[model samples]
Target: MTRKLLLVLLFLMAVEMNAQKGESNFSLGFNYGFGSEFSNRNYMFTNQFYKVQLYYRLKETKHFQYQILVQPEINFAEHQLLNFYFVKPDTPNYQQKRDEFTRLKDIREYVLNCGFLVRKPIGKTCSFYVLGSIGPMITDTETERMSKGFAFADVLAVGFAASYDKFKFDIRPSVRHVSNAGLGSSNAGYNTKNIEFGISCQL
Candidate 1:
Protein backbone atom coordinates (compact mmCIF):
# COMPACT_ATOMS: atom_id res chain seq x y z
CA MET A 1 0.00 0.00 0.00
CA THR A 2 2.79 2.40 0.89
CA ARG A 3 4.59 1.61 -2.39
CA LYS A 4 1.42 2.41 -4.38
CA LEU A 5 1.03 5.78 -2.61
CA LEU A 6 4.65 6.77 -3.35
CA LEU A 7 4.23 5.90 -7.03
CA VAL A 8 1.10 8.04 -7.26
CA LEU A 9 2.82 11.04 -5.69
CA LEU A 10 5.79 10.75 -8.09
CA PHE A 11 3.50 10.63 -11.10
CA LEU A 12 1.64 13.77 -10.00
CA MET A 13 4.87 15.73 -9.62
CA ALA A 14 6.07 14.74 -13.06
CA VAL A 15 2.80 15.80 -14.65
CA GLU A 16 2.90 19.20 -12.95
CA MET A 17 6.44 19.88 -14.18
CA ASN A 18 5.52 18.99 -17.72
CA ALA A 19 2.47 21.28 -17.60
CA GLN A 20 4.57 24.21 -16.52
CA LYS A 21 7.03 23.62 -19.32
CA GLY A 22 4.24 23.64 -21.90
CA GLU A 23 2.56 26.80 -20.59
CA SER A 24 2.17 29.62 -23.09
CA ASN A 25 2.48 33.24 -21.89
CA PHE A 26 4.16 34.88 -24.84
CA SER A 27 2.43 37.59 -26.90
CA LEU A 28 2.65 39.72 -30.03
CA GLY A 29 0.84 43.04 -30.42
CA PHE A 30 0.23 46.19 -32.48
CA ASN A 31 0.49 49.92 -31.68
CA TYR A 32 -1.19 53.10 -32.95
CA GLY A 33 -0.22 56.61 -31.89
CA PHE A 34 0.17 60.32 -32.80
CA GLY A 35 3.03 62.77 -32.43
CA SER A 36 4.90 65.72 -33.96
CA GLU A 37 8.38 66.39 -35.33
CA PHE A 38 10.25 69.69 -35.43
CA SER A 39 13.46 70.71 -37.13
CA ASN A 40 15.50 73.87 -36.80
CA ARG A 41 14.03 75.20 -40.03
CA ASN A 42 10.75 73.25 -40.25
CA TYR A 43 8.03 71.85 -37.96
CA MET A 44 5.09 69.53 -38.70
CA PHE A 45 2.64 67.14 -37.03
CA THR A 46 2.97 63.42 -37.74
CA ASN A 47 -0.01 61.36 -38.75
CA GLN A 48 -1.01 58.11 -37.03
CA PHE A 49 1.68 55.40 -37.33
CA TYR A 50 1.69 51.65 -36.85
CA LYS A 51 3.89 49.56 -34.51
CA VAL A 52 4.55 45.80 -34.15
CA GLN A 53 5.90 44.00 -31.09
CA LEU A 54 6.85 40.50 -29.83
CA TYR A 55 7.02 39.77 -26.08
CA TYR A 56 7.87 36.85 -23.78
CA ARG A 57 7.43 36.27 -20.02
CA LEU A 58 8.05 33.55 -17.50
CA LYS A 59 5.11 31.62 -16.11
CA GLU A 60 6.27 31.59 -12.48
CA THR A 61 8.09 34.90 -11.97
CA LYS A 62 6.79 37.32 -14.60
CA HIS A 63 8.96 40.05 -13.17
CA PHE A 64 11.78 39.68 -15.75
CA GLN A 65 10.80 39.75 -19.43
CA TYR A 66 11.98 41.19 -22.75
CA GLN A 67 10.34 42.48 -25.94
CA ILE A 68 11.25 43.46 -29.48
CA LEU A 69 9.45 46.25 -31.40
CA VAL A 70 9.38 47.47 -35.01
CA GLN A 71 7.79 50.66 -36.30
CA PRO A 72 7.10 52.24 -39.72
CA GLU A 73 5.71 55.76 -39.51
CA ILE A 74 4.43 58.73 -41.62
CA ASN A 75 4.55 62.54 -41.16
CA PHE A 76 2.21 65.13 -42.71
CA ALA A 77 2.26 68.86 -43.31
CA GLU A 78 0.87 71.57 -45.69
CA HIS A 79 1.93 75.02 -46.97
CA GLN A 80 5.46 74.47 -45.64
CA LEU A 81 7.93 77.13 -46.71
CA LEU A 82 11.36 76.18 -48.07
CA ASN A 83 14.02 78.86 -47.54
CA PHE A 84 16.69 79.47 -50.23
CA TYR A 85 20.02 81.14 -49.65
CA PHE A 86 22.74 82.43 -52.05
CA VAL A 87 26.24 83.79 -51.35
CA LYS A 88 28.07 86.47 -53.36
CA PRO A 89 31.84 87.06 -52.87
CA ASP A 90 31.96 90.93 -53.05
CA THR A 91 28.46 91.97 -51.83
CA PRO A 92 27.51 92.98 -48.25
CA ASN A 93 24.44 90.70 -48.45
CA TYR A 94 26.17 87.59 -49.77
CA GLN A 95 23.04 85.46 -49.28
CA GLN A 96 20.24 86.03 -51.84
CA LYS A 97 16.74 84.54 -51.56
CA ARG A 98 14.06 83.30 -53.94
CA ASP A 99 10.29 83.10 -53.28
CA GLU A 100 8.93 80.74 -55.91
CA PHE A 101 5.88 78.53 -56.26
CA THR A 102 4.10 77.81 -52.97
CA ARG A 103 2.43 74.43 -53.10
CA LEU A 104 1.82 71.52 -50.72
CA LYS A 105 3.72 68.24 -51.03
CA ASP A 106 3.72 65.10 -48.91
CA ILE A 107 7.12 63.83 -47.73
CA ARG A 108 7.30 60.03 -47.77
CA GLU A 109 9.45 58.27 -45.16
CA TYR A 110 10.24 54.74 -43.88
CA VAL A 111 11.69 53.80 -40.45
CA LEU A 112 13.04 50.49 -39.04
CA ASN A 113 13.79 50.32 -35.28
CA CYS A 114 14.63 47.48 -32.84
CA GLY A 115 14.07 48.04 -29.09
CA PHE A 116 15.22 45.99 -26.07
CA LEU A 117 12.64 46.13 -23.30
CA VAL A 118 12.74 45.06 -19.62
CA ARG A 119 9.72 44.73 -17.35
CA LYS A 120 9.00 44.37 -13.59
CA PRO A 121 5.65 42.94 -12.59
CA ILE A 122 3.47 44.80 -10.09
CA GLY A 123 0.24 43.12 -8.91
CA LYS A 124 -1.23 39.87 -10.27
CA THR A 125 -0.94 41.18 -13.86
CA CYS A 126 0.59 44.64 -14.09
CA SER A 127 4.10 45.93 -14.75
CA PHE A 128 6.29 48.96 -15.50
CA TYR A 129 9.20 48.92 -17.92
CA VAL A 130 11.72 50.89 -19.97
CA LEU A 131 13.20 50.49 -23.45
CA GLY A 132 16.16 51.84 -25.44
CA SER A 133 16.72 51.59 -29.18
CA ILE A 134 18.29 53.00 -32.35
CA GLY A 135 17.54 52.47 -36.04
CA PRO A 136 17.79 53.69 -39.67
CA MET A 137 15.29 55.94 -41.45
CA ILE A 138 14.85 57.13 -45.06
CA THR A 139 12.98 60.13 -46.44
CA ASP A 140 11.86 61.03 -49.98
CA THR A 141 12.23 64.71 -50.75
CA GLU A 142 11.97 66.98 -53.83
CA THR A 143 14.57 69.63 -54.53
CA GLU A 144 15.22 72.33 -57.17
CA ARG A 145 17.59 71.93 -60.13
CA MET A 146 20.59 73.50 -58.33
CA SER A 147 20.16 71.30 -55.26
CA LYS A 148 22.83 68.80 -54.21
CA GLY A 149 20.94 65.65 -53.14
CA PHE A 150 17.84 64.22 -51.46
CA ALA A 151 17.43 64.88 -47.73
CA PHE A 152 18.22 62.09 -45.28
CA ALA A 153 16.64 61.58 -41.82
CA ASP A 154 18.21 59.73 -38.87
CA VAL A 155 16.11 58.52 -35.91
CA LEU A 156 16.73 57.52 -32.26
CA ALA A 157 14.08 56.95 -29.56
CA VAL A 158 14.01 56.04 -25.83
CA GLY A 159 11.06 55.78 -23.45
CA PHE A 160 9.13 54.06 -20.66
CA ALA A 161 6.14 51.68 -20.72
CA ALA A 162 3.21 50.86 -18.42
CA SER A 163 1.03 47.77 -18.85
CA TYR A 164 -2.27 46.62 -17.33
CA ASP A 165 -3.64 43.16 -17.95
CA LYS A 166 -6.97 41.49 -17.14
CA PHE A 167 -7.44 37.84 -18.15
CA LYS A 168 -6.34 37.67 -21.82
CA PHE A 169 -6.47 41.35 -22.75
CA ASP A 170 -3.56 43.73 -22.20
CA ILE A 171 -3.33 47.51 -22.55
CA ARG A 172 0.09 49.15 -22.74
CA PRO A 173 0.88 52.83 -22.99
CA SER A 174 4.32 54.26 -23.76
CA VAL A 175 5.79 57.75 -23.95
CA ARG A 176 8.99 58.56 -25.82
CA HIS A 177 11.10 61.37 -27.23
CA VAL A 178 12.97 60.91 -30.50
CA SER A 179 16.09 62.71 -31.63
CA ASN A 180 16.55 63.29 -35.33
CA ALA A 181 20.13 63.16 -36.59
CA GLY A 182 20.28 65.64 -39.47
CA LEU A 183 20.59 63.94 -42.83
CA GLY A 184 20.58 66.83 -45.32
CA SER A 185 21.96 70.30 -44.61
CA SER A 186 24.97 70.94 -42.42
CA ASN A 187 22.82 72.93 -39.96
CA ALA A 188 19.94 70.48 -39.95
CA GLY A 189 18.57 69.65 -36.51
CA TYR A 190 15.55 67.40 -35.84
CA ASN A 191 13.49 66.34 -32.77
CA THR A 192 10.05 64.83 -32.12
CA LYS A 193 7.57 64.06 -29.28
CA ASN A 194 5.54 60.83 -29.17
CA ILE A 195 2.89 58.94 -27.13
CA GLU A 196 1.63 55.49 -28.09
CA PHE A 197 -1.01 52.94 -27.02
CA GLY A 198 -0.53 49.22 -27.60
CA ILE A 199 -2.96 46.29 -27.42
CA SER A 200 -2.17 42.58 -27.36
CA CYS A 201 -3.33 39.09 -26.40
CA GLN A 202 -2.13 35.49 -26.10
CA LEU A 203 -3.29 32.76 -28.47
Candidate 2:
Protein backbone atom coordinates (compact mmCIF):
# COMPACT_ATOMS: atom_id res chain seq x y z
CA MET A 1 0.00 0.00 0.00
CA THR A 2 2.78 2.43 0.81
CA ARG A 3 4.59 1.74 -2.48
CA LYS A 4 1.41 2.40 -4.51
CA LEU A 5 0.75 5.64 -2.64
CA LEU A 6 4.31 6.85 -3.29
CA LEU A 7 3.96 6.17 -7.02
CA VAL A 8 0.78 8.31 -7.20
CA LEU A 9 2.49 11.14 -5.38
CA LEU A 10 5.41 11.11 -7.83
CA PHE A 11 3.05 11.29 -10.83
CA LEU A 12 1.16 14.23 -9.32
CA MET A 13 4.38 16.11 -8.63
CA ALA A 14 5.60 15.62 -12.18
CA VAL A 15 2.32 16.92 -13.60
CA GLU A 16 2.45 19.96 -11.35
CA MET A 17 6.03 20.75 -12.35
CA ASN A 18 5.16 20.57 -16.04
CA ALA A 19 2.11 22.80 -15.65
CA GLN A 20 4.17 25.50 -13.99
CA LYS A 21 6.56 25.74 -16.95
CA GLY A 22 4.11 27.91 -18.90
CA GLU A 23 3.75 27.89 -22.72
CA SER A 24 6.68 28.63 -24.99
CA ASN A 25 5.14 30.18 -28.11
CA PHE A 26 6.82 30.15 -31.54
CA SER A 27 4.87 29.86 -34.79
CA LEU A 28 5.86 29.27 -38.45
CA GLY A 29 3.34 29.17 -41.28
CA PHE A 30 2.96 29.19 -45.09
CA ASN A 31 0.36 30.58 -47.51
CA TYR A 32 -0.44 30.29 -51.24
CA GLY A 33 -3.17 32.19 -53.11
CA PHE A 34 -4.57 33.12 -56.50
CA GLY A 35 -3.58 36.65 -57.36
CA SER A 36 -3.66 39.35 -60.09
CA GLU A 37 -2.36 42.84 -60.78
CA PHE A 38 -4.28 46.03 -61.65
CA SER A 39 -2.59 48.45 -64.03
CA ASN A 40 -3.58 51.18 -66.57
CA ARG A 41 -7.11 51.35 -65.16
CA ASN A 42 -7.84 47.84 -66.35
CA TYR A 43 -7.17 44.25 -65.35
CA MET A 44 -4.22 43.34 -67.53
CA PHE A 45 -5.25 40.33 -69.58
CA THR A 46 -2.64 38.30 -67.73
CA ASN A 47 -3.35 35.22 -65.66
CA GLN A 48 -1.79 35.85 -62.26
CA PHE A 49 -0.21 32.76 -60.74
CA TYR A 50 0.26 31.52 -57.18
CA LYS A 51 2.76 32.93 -54.68
CA VAL A 52 4.38 30.98 -51.82
CA GLN A 53 4.79 32.82 -48.53
CA LEU A 54 6.42 31.96 -45.19
CA TYR A 55 5.71 33.55 -41.81
CA TYR A 56 7.27 33.59 -38.34
CA ARG A 57 6.06 35.24 -35.16
CA LEU A 58 7.01 35.55 -31.50
CA LYS A 59 4.64 36.46 -28.70
CA GLU A 60 5.52 39.49 -26.58
CA THR A 61 2.43 40.02 -24.47
CA LYS A 62 -0.98 38.40 -24.91
CA HIS A 63 -2.03 40.71 -27.72
CA PHE A 64 1.07 42.08 -29.48
CA GLN A 65 4.16 40.49 -31.05
CA TYR A 66 6.69 40.63 -33.89
CA GLN A 67 6.10 39.03 -37.32
CA ILE A 68 8.03 38.68 -40.61
CA LEU A 69 7.20 37.26 -44.05
CA VAL A 70 8.85 36.11 -47.31
CA GLN A 71 6.90 35.76 -50.56
CA PRO A 72 7.96 34.55 -54.05
CA GLU A 73 5.64 34.34 -57.05
CA ILE A 74 5.48 32.81 -60.55
CA ASN A 75 3.20 34.31 -63.22
CA PHE A 76 1.75 33.11 -66.53
CA ALA A 77 0.12 35.66 -68.80
CA GLU A 78 -2.89 35.62 -71.09
CA HIS A 79 -2.93 37.21 -74.55
CA GLN A 80 -3.40 40.99 -74.44
CA LEU A 81 -4.99 43.37 -76.98
CA LEU A 82 -2.96 46.57 -77.09
CA ASN A 83 -1.96 49.18 -79.67
CA PHE A 84 1.65 50.24 -80.19
CA TYR A 85 2.91 53.55 -81.59
CA PHE A 86 6.45 54.05 -82.75
CA VAL A 87 8.68 56.79 -84.25
CA LYS A 88 9.20 56.11 -87.95
CA PRO A 89 12.81 55.01 -88.08
CA ASP A 90 15.19 55.53 -91.06
CA THR A 91 13.94 52.17 -92.36
CA PRO A 92 10.86 50.80 -94.05
CA ASN A 93 9.97 48.11 -91.47
CA TYR A 94 10.15 50.27 -88.31
CA GLN A 95 6.40 50.29 -87.59
CA GLN A 96 6.03 46.63 -88.55
CA LYS A 97 8.80 45.53 -86.21
CA ARG A 98 7.37 47.66 -83.38
CA ASP A 99 3.95 46.08 -83.80
CA GLU A 100 5.39 42.57 -83.63
CA PHE A 101 7.48 43.46 -80.59
CA THR A 102 4.51 44.83 -78.65
CA ARG A 103 2.69 41.49 -78.70
CA LEU A 104 4.05 39.27 -75.94
CA LYS A 105 3.88 35.48 -75.56
CA ASP A 106 4.83 34.88 -71.92
CA ILE A 107 5.89 36.85 -68.88
CA ARG A 108 6.99 36.36 -65.25
CA GLU A 109 6.86 38.62 -62.21
CA TYR A 110 8.93 38.11 -59.05
CA VAL A 111 8.84 40.04 -55.80
CA LEU A 112 10.55 39.88 -52.40
CA ASN A 113 9.08 41.61 -49.35
CA CYS A 114 10.06 42.05 -45.68
CA GLY A 115 7.88 43.81 -43.11
CA PHE A 116 6.02 43.79 -39.79
CA LEU A 117 2.59 42.46 -38.82
CA VAL A 118 0.39 43.38 -35.85
CA ARG A 119 -2.00 41.01 -34.16
CA LYS A 120 -4.75 41.01 -31.54
CA PRO A 121 -5.39 37.58 -30.08
CA ILE A 122 -9.15 37.31 -29.73
CA GLY A 123 -9.16 34.69 -26.99
CA LYS A 124 -6.41 32.09 -27.26
CA THR A 125 -3.25 31.93 -29.41
CA CYS A 126 -5.29 32.59 -32.56
CA SER A 127 -5.54 36.18 -33.78
CA PHE A 128 -6.47 38.51 -36.68
CA TYR A 129 -4.48 41.49 -37.87
CA VAL A 130 -3.19 43.74 -40.68
CA LEU A 131 0.23 43.56 -42.43
CA GLY A 132 2.14 46.30 -44.27
CA SER A 133 5.45 45.96 -46.08
CA ILE A 134 7.93 47.36 -48.68
CA GLY A 135 10.25 45.56 -51.04
CA PRO A 136 11.68 45.20 -54.59
CA MET A 137 9.91 43.56 -57.54
CA ILE A 138 11.18 42.22 -60.87
CA THR A 139 9.17 41.66 -64.06
CA ASP A 140 10.36 39.78 -67.12
CA THR A 141 8.85 38.67 -70.41
CA GLU A 142 10.12 36.29 -73.06
CA THR A 143 9.82 38.89 -75.83
CA GLU A 144 11.59 42.27 -75.54
CA ARG A 145 13.71 44.57 -73.36
CA MET A 146 10.85 47.04 -72.85
CA SER A 147 8.94 44.15 -71.32
CA LYS A 148 11.50 42.98 -68.74
CA GLY A 149 13.15 44.86 -65.87
CA PHE A 150 13.47 45.20 -62.09
CA ALA A 151 11.85 47.91 -60.01
CA PHE A 152 11.22 48.93 -56.45
CA ALA A 153 7.72 47.68 -55.57
CA ASP A 154 6.13 48.89 -52.36
CA VAL A 155 4.05 46.34 -50.49
CA LEU A 156 0.90 47.49 -48.69
CA ALA A 157 -0.94 44.52 -47.28
CA VAL A 158 -3.80 43.55 -44.95
CA GLY A 159 -5.07 40.10 -44.01
CA PHE A 160 -6.67 37.82 -41.43
CA ALA A 161 -5.56 34.49 -40.01
CA ALA A 162 -7.10 31.59 -38.05
CA SER A 163 -4.64 29.50 -36.06
CA TYR A 164 -4.91 26.18 -34.18
CA ASP A 165 -2.34 25.22 -31.58
CA LYS A 166 -1.57 21.83 -30.02
CA PHE A 167 1.24 22.58 -27.61
CA LYS A 168 4.23 22.90 -29.99
CA PHE A 169 2.32 22.35 -33.25
CA ASP A 170 0.32 25.03 -35.08
CA ILE A 171 -1.72 25.32 -38.26
CA ARG A 172 -2.71 28.62 -39.83
CA PRO A 173 -4.69 29.66 -42.88
CA SER A 174 -4.65 33.28 -44.07
CA VAL A 175 -5.64 35.62 -46.93
CA ARG A 176 -4.03 38.90 -47.93
CA HIS A 177 -3.84 41.52 -50.73
CA VAL A 178 -0.63 43.24 -51.85
CA SER A 179 -0.39 46.32 -54.08
CA ASN A 180 2.48 47.58 -56.20
CA ALA A 181 2.46 51.37 -56.80
CA GLY A 182 5.45 52.02 -59.10
CA LEU A 183 9.19 51.84 -59.62
CA GLY A 184 11.68 54.49 -60.86
CA SER A 185 10.38 54.64 -64.43
CA SER A 186 9.41 51.12 -65.42
CA ASN A 187 6.05 51.09 -63.73
CA ALA A 188 4.59 47.57 -63.73
CA GLY A 189 1.82 48.73 -61.50
CA TYR A 190 -0.67 46.16 -60.30
CA ASN A 191 -2.51 44.85 -57.24
CA THR A 192 -1.20 41.36 -56.40
CA LYS A 193 -3.59 39.38 -54.22
CA ASN A 194 -3.28 35.96 -52.53
CA ILE A 195 -4.99 33.42 -50.21
CA GLU A 196 -2.90 30.85 -48.40
CA PHE A 197 -3.40 27.80 -46.15
CA GLY A 198 -0.44 26.22 -44.34
CA ILE A 199 0.71 24.08 -41.38
CA SER A 200 3.75 24.64 -39.11
CA CYS A 201 5.51 23.26 -36.04
CA GLN A 202 7.09 25.24 -33.19
CA LEU A 203 10.19 23.88 -31.46
Candidate 3:
Protein backbone atom coordinates (compact mmCIF):
# COMPACT_ATOMS: atom_id res chain seq x y z
CA MET A 1 0.00 0.00 0.00
CA THR A 2 2.79 2.40 0.80
CA ARG A 3 4.48 1.72 -2.50
CA LYS A 4 1.29 2.30 -4.41
CA LEU A 5 0.66 5.57 -2.64
CA LEU A 6 4.18 6.76 -3.34
CA LEU A 7 3.80 6.00 -7.03
CA VAL A 8 0.54 7.87 -7.20
CA LEU A 9 2.05 10.89 -5.50
CA LEU A 10 4.92 10.89 -7.95
CA PHE A 11 2.53 10.78 -10.85
CA LEU A 12 0.60 13.73 -9.45
CA MET A 13 3.78 15.71 -9.00
CA ALA A 14 4.72 15.16 -12.61
CA VAL A 15 1.34 16.35 -13.77
CA GLU A 16 1.53 19.37 -11.53
CA MET A 17 4.86 20.35 -13.03
CA ASN A 18 3.48 20.05 -16.54
CA ALA A 19 0.49 22.14 -15.64
CA GLN A 20 2.74 24.77 -14.14
CA LYS A 21 4.72 24.91 -17.37
CA GLY A 22 1.51 25.70 -19.20
CA GLU A 23 0.71 28.53 -16.77
CA SER A 24 -2.47 26.85 -15.63
CA ASN A 25 -4.41 27.87 -12.59
CA PHE A 26 -3.96 25.82 -9.41
CA SER A 27 -6.45 25.17 -6.63
CA LEU A 28 -6.65 23.20 -3.41
CA GLY A 29 -9.87 21.74 -2.09
CA PHE A 30 -11.22 19.89 0.90
CA ASN A 31 -14.31 17.73 0.72
CA TYR A 32 -16.51 15.59 2.91
CA GLY A 33 -18.97 12.97 1.72
CA PHE A 34 -21.43 10.56 3.29
CA GLY A 35 -23.39 7.71 1.74
CA SER A 36 -24.82 4.21 2.05
CA GLU A 37 -24.80 1.07 0.00
CA PHE A 38 -27.20 0.83 -2.95
CA SER A 39 -26.56 -2.75 -3.97
CA ASN A 40 -28.94 -5.59 -3.06
CA ARG A 41 -26.50 -7.67 -1.07
CA ASN A 42 -28.53 -8.53 2.03
CA TYR A 43 -26.31 -6.31 4.09
CA MET A 44 -26.31 -2.85 5.58
CA PHE A 45 -23.34 -0.62 4.86
CA THR A 46 -22.63 3.05 5.19
CA ASN A 47 -19.55 5.18 4.68
CA GLN A 48 -18.10 8.63 5.20
CA PHE A 49 -15.22 10.06 3.26
CA TYR A 50 -12.70 12.84 3.77
CA LYS A 51 -10.72 14.02 0.80
CA VAL A 52 -8.14 16.58 -0.31
CA GLN A 53 -8.01 17.56 -3.94
CA LEU A 54 -5.49 19.26 -6.21
CA TYR A 55 -6.81 20.80 -9.39
CA TYR A 56 -5.09 22.20 -12.43
CA ARG A 57 -6.91 23.86 -15.25
CA LEU A 58 -5.89 22.50 -18.62
CA LYS A 59 -7.92 24.47 -21.09
CA GLU A 60 -10.63 27.10 -21.18
CA THR A 61 -13.16 28.48 -23.65
CA LYS A 62 -15.84 31.10 -23.41
CA HIS A 63 -18.40 28.51 -22.29
CA PHE A 64 -16.37 25.63 -20.83
CA GLN A 65 -13.19 24.72 -19.01
CA TYR A 66 -11.30 21.46 -18.58
CA GLN A 67 -9.21 20.46 -15.61
CA ILE A 68 -7.22 17.58 -14.22
CA LEU A 69 -7.70 16.55 -10.63
CA VAL A 70 -5.89 14.41 -8.11
CA GLN A 71 -7.59 13.43 -4.93
CA PRO A 72 -6.50 11.41 -1.93
CA GLU A 73 -9.23 10.18 0.35
CA ILE A 74 -10.00 8.01 3.32
CA ASN A 75 -13.25 6.15 3.87
CA PHE A 76 -14.69 5.04 7.18
CA ALA A 77 -17.40 2.43 7.00
CA GLU A 78 -19.73 0.27 9.06
CA HIS A 79 -21.09 -3.00 7.72
CA GLN A 80 -23.30 -5.84 8.92
CA LEU A 81 -24.77 -8.81 7.14
CA LEU A 82 -28.54 -8.99 7.38
CA ASN A 83 -29.25 -12.39 5.89
CA PHE A 84 -27.85 -15.87 5.37
CA TYR A 85 -28.91 -16.31 1.77
CA PHE A 86 -25.45 -17.33 0.64
CA VAL A 87 -25.00 -19.88 3.39
CA LYS A 88 -26.49 -23.25 2.58
CA PRO A 89 -28.22 -25.61 5.00
CA ASP A 90 -25.50 -28.23 4.66
CA THR A 91 -22.64 -25.89 5.31
CA PRO A 92 -20.35 -26.70 8.17
CA ASN A 93 -20.52 -24.50 11.25
CA TYR A 94 -23.57 -22.70 9.95
CA GLN A 95 -24.27 -21.13 13.29
CA GLN A 96 -20.75 -19.77 13.49
CA LYS A 97 -20.99 -18.25 10.04
CA ARG A 98 -24.23 -16.59 11.01
CA ASP A 99 -22.74 -15.23 14.18
CA GLU A 100 -19.76 -13.77 12.42
CA PHE A 101 -21.66 -12.31 9.52
CA THR A 102 -24.31 -10.68 11.67
CA ARG A 103 -21.84 -8.77 13.77
CA LEU A 104 -21.15 -5.16 12.80
CA LYS A 105 -17.64 -4.40 11.59
CA ASP A 106 -15.70 -1.20 11.03
CA ILE A 107 -13.74 -0.87 7.83
CA ARG A 108 -11.37 1.69 6.40
CA GLU A 109 -10.22 2.42 2.88
CA TYR A 110 -7.43 4.53 1.38
CA VAL A 111 -7.73 5.77 -2.18
CA LEU A 112 -5.98 8.02 -4.67
CA ASN A 113 -8.05 9.23 -7.60
CA CYS A 114 -6.82 10.80 -10.82
CA GLY A 115 -9.37 12.10 -13.24
CA PHE A 116 -10.71 14.87 -15.43
CA LEU A 117 -13.43 17.45 -15.03
CA VAL A 118 -15.45 19.41 -17.52
CA ARG A 119 -17.10 22.58 -16.34
CA LYS A 120 -19.66 24.86 -17.96
CA PRO A 121 -20.28 28.30 -16.65
CA ILE A 122 -23.81 29.31 -15.77
CA GLY A 123 -22.92 32.82 -14.68
CA LYS A 124 -19.94 34.85 -13.51
CA THR A 125 -19.90 33.29 -10.06
CA CYS A 126 -21.45 29.85 -10.60
CA SER A 127 -20.81 26.83 -12.79
CA PHE A 128 -21.66 23.16 -13.16
CA TYR A 129 -19.17 20.35 -13.59
CA VAL A 130 -19.11 16.65 -14.34
CA LEU A 131 -16.33 14.46 -13.08
CA GLY A 132 -15.20 10.87 -13.55
CA SER A 133 -12.35 9.20 -11.75
CA ILE A 134 -10.88 5.78 -11.04
CA GLY A 135 -8.08 4.89 -8.68
CA PRO A 136 -6.38 2.20 -6.62
CA MET A 137 -7.63 1.51 -3.14
CA ILE A 138 -6.64 -0.45 -0.07
CA THR A 139 -9.31 -1.93 2.16
CA ASP A 140 -8.47 -2.61 5.76
CA THR A 141 -11.22 -5.08 6.63
CA GLU A 142 -12.83 -8.18 5.18
CA THR A 143 -16.56 -8.68 4.62
CA GLU A 144 -18.86 -11.29 3.17
CA ARG A 145 -18.99 -9.58 -0.21
CA MET A 146 -15.61 -7.91 -0.36
CA SER A 147 -12.13 -8.99 0.65
CA LYS A 148 -9.49 -7.01 2.44
CA GLY A 149 -6.46 -5.64 0.53
CA PHE A 150 -6.26 -4.21 -2.95
CA ALA A 151 -9.28 -2.99 -4.89
CA PHE A 152 -10.39 -0.20 -7.21
CA ALA A 153 -12.54 2.83 -6.51
CA ASP A 154 -14.50 4.45 -9.29
CA VAL A 155 -16.58 7.62 -9.04
CA LEU A 156 -18.95 9.67 -11.15
CA ALA A 157 -20.23 13.01 -10.04
CA VAL A 158 -22.02 16.14 -11.12
CA GLY A 159 -21.66 19.30 -9.07
CA PHE A 160 -22.40 22.97 -8.77
CA ALA A 161 -19.77 25.45 -7.71
CA ALA A 162 -20.18 29.04 -6.61
CA SER A 163 -17.20 31.30 -6.34
CA TYR A 164 -16.51 34.36 -4.21
CA ASP A 165 -13.32 35.87 -5.49
CA LYS A 166 -10.59 33.29 -4.78
CA PHE A 167 -12.81 31.01 -2.72
CA LYS A 168 -15.26 28.50 -4.13
CA PHE A 169 -17.97 26.40 -2.51
CA ASP A 170 -19.25 23.18 -4.04
CA ILE A 171 -22.13 20.75 -3.64
CA ARG A 172 -21.87 17.47 -5.45
CA PRO A 173 -23.84 14.28 -5.68
CA SER A 174 -21.93 11.19 -6.72
CA VAL A 175 -22.00 7.42 -7.17
CA ARG A 176 -19.11 5.27 -6.07
CA HIS A 177 -18.12 1.66 -6.71
CA VAL A 178 -15.43 -0.45 -5.13
CA SER A 179 -14.40 -3.84 -6.50
CA ASN A 180 -11.39 -6.06 -6.87
CA ALA A 181 -11.89 -6.62 -10.61
CA GLY A 182 -11.91 -10.38 -9.92
CA LEU A 183 -8.40 -10.27 -8.53
CA GLY A 184 -9.52 -11.54 -5.14
CA SER A 185 -11.68 -14.35 -3.88
CA SER A 186 -14.53 -12.05 -2.92
CA ASN A 187 -15.48 -9.67 -5.71
CA ALA A 188 -19.09 -8.66 -5.23
CA GLY A 189 -17.81 -5.33 -3.87
CA TYR A 190 -19.92 -2.31 -2.95
CA ASN A 191 -21.94 0.36 -4.73
CA THR A 192 -22.94 3.57 -3.01
CA LYS A 193 -24.60 6.91 -3.62
CA ASN A 194 -23.01 9.91 -1.97
CA ILE A 195 -23.43 13.65 -1.51
CA GLU A 196 -20.40 15.80 -0.90
CA PHE A 197 -19.76 19.34 0.29
CA GLY A 198 -16.53 21.05 -0.53
CA ILE A 199 -14.60 24.31 -0.27
CA SER A 200 -11.63 25.35 -2.35
CA CYS A 201 -9.24 28.22 -2.82
CA GLN A 202 -7.42 29.22 -5.95
CA LEU A 203 -3.65 29.66 -5.84
Q: Best lDDT goes to which candidate?
A: 3
Query: Hey, what RMSD does candidate 2 come out at?
Result: 13.1
Order the candidate numbers by lDDT, best to worst.
Answer: 3, 2, 1
User: Between candidates 1 and 3, which one is better according to lDDT?
Assistant: 3
lDDT to native, each model: 0.46, 0.48, 0.88
**How many residue pairs clash (N, CA or C atoms closer than 3 angstroms) in each of the candidate models, in the order given?**
0, 3, 0
Models sorted by TM-score, best on top: 3, 2, 1
> Model 1, 1-203: lDDT tens per residue?
33464365446545555666664444556766655554534333344566554444433343566655444344442223343442224534334312331234454444555566666666656666666655554445432211223333343443334445423333343443432344443323234556667776542
lDDT of 2 by residue, 1-203 (tens): 33464365446545654665664233333444444444443224445455444445644675576666554555555433243433237535767755665665566666665667776666665656667766665666422222356654454555454555542222333333322343232233444544444454442
Q: After superposing candidate 1, which stretches have Cα over 4 Å from the reference?
A: 1-21, 24-26, 38-42, 56-63, 72-104, 142-189
Clashing pairs in 2: 32-196, 33-195, 38-191
